[model samples]
Target: MGLDTPRPRAAARHPARSSPPRRSLHGLSGPPPAHERTPLIRSCHMTHRSRRQRMHPTNTPSRRADSPIESLWPHRYSGVMISIVIADDHGIVREGLKRLLEVEPEFEVCGEAKNGREVLDAVERSRPDIVVLDITMPHLGGLETLERLRNEYGDTKVILLSVHNDPTFIQSAIGLRADGYVLKDGRAEEIVTAIREVMKGGSYFSPAVAKKIVEQARSPKSKSSDPFTLLSAREREVLRLIADGLSAKEVATELSISTKTVEAHRTSLMRKLDVRKATELVRYALRHGLIEP
Candidate 1:
């Protein structure tokens, strides 16, 4: 159902709960225009000069000893380096990726983050061309983070790195139009290949992930439509807030909209999900992996 569903205006009888600062989907009120919703890519750089220096310790020719001189001179004239941000919860994992990608003179490790929020911040500041992100993180999960990145920062490509190979996770990433999906256990060369493929306007999935997609295509169970496709972006945002235990008034305040508008969105969500109660909505969200249990 559309978010245009209407509900009668009611008086606010309860108070909005105090909540920690979090990202808002539609600025705090009604659905913002498409152009206004996605942030403009301002030219900015991450202030991690010292940290990046620490990541690459040597200044000698031995680092490039194995590379042919012919390959190194082309990038200098082209003035193009594929910028990347590595987002992983583990410091060691980030370090490993940074070092691996740094070996390629054409690739630059521009920034790094430990969680979803930090990832957002890093991307905004660095304006990296690509983001290599872990699938599971605290504060926000990878799937949700991918949605935000696609919506708000449309220019950057995202590659999901995960330990899980479940069909649900694989399908979600594909639906979200992720540029690549690579398993953490895969060989280092796979990541390099994925980066190159995605940069060339192509997509890549790990061998195991590709096999899962093929198996899913052959299975009858894969034909079922995802219920999430039925809800509009605004309705989905309202559902997430409500599932997070926010009251209608609180959701209105958080979204910068009137209570009547929030109520209308809720009504539309209920109608679309075929649920009658707030608890049922929460259950639907949990079942669909919209919110944590």
Candidate 2:
């Protein structure tokens, strides 16, 4: 035991103690003072704040002031609304067309008319970009209205809407420089597409109408047998009115013509159509689409 004492005081006996229980920051009364905080904790707070700032930046990009037109109508004419006037003899037809056209953001229906006479008034008042006109309106026919518009408002585009796909009607519209021809029986989208095409400085026709036009172009004699083509515009107007059961005096008043002139037109119509009686004239007008049956 003598030299063993030098061997180490038998390594002093000590009680085995478990590791101290871990303490969470949340469980603490408060965070340690800033200087007492560990570099790792401070670094974590700074990193979290930096990440939040990066995710939700305060600044936003600015929009250009001169891009309103580009933003509104990126695919169409810059900044311009395509103004339109719809003319149809039937109120329901006009209402339907208005409702259909109003859906397009770029289209604006500026005016409406029930007949060709009102069409002129609407065009004068609104100065619209396009006119969708019906062919067989009362008082003034569509072809006559188109001619007047071509003369008065040369810049305004005209699209003819007709139920007839006859070559005579198509040729007449083409001759009058109609920008488009859309049949009433066509799909509703056809009219919308026609307006867009006409606005683009191009022409559009229903497939049937286009085919009729091509047929007429190929055969000039196709319309010769149709006696309706032999009638003058004034004579046609007289026939339509006469067929509607208007007397010579009423026709004169409606047309602002003398009764004698109306009688003369009646005679011309009868001679051209080879009809002797007023009843026959009505039948012919009905058969030839001069008046609504």
Best by lDDT: 2
Judge candidate 2 at residue 275 and give its lDDT: 85
Model 1 lDDT per residue over 104-124, tens place? 756888889988778899898
TM-score of 2: 0.72
Q: What is the TM-score of each candidate against the true structure?
A: 0.56, 0.72
Q: Over the stretch 1-293, how does candidate 2's per-residue lDDT look in tens digits?
A: 69656655575488778775543322224554454332221111123345345334456332343555445544432223567899998999999999999887567787899988899998887777789999999988888788889989898899999998877677778877999999999899999999988877899999998888778768878878688777666787788889999999999999898999999889888888898999999898888687876
- Model 1 residue 114 CA deviation in Å: 1.3
Q: How many backbone clashes does candidate 1 have?
A: 5
**Stretches of model 2 off by over 4 angstroms after superposition:** 1-77
lDDT of each: 0.76, 0.79
Candidate 2: residue 246 Cα off by (Å): 0.6
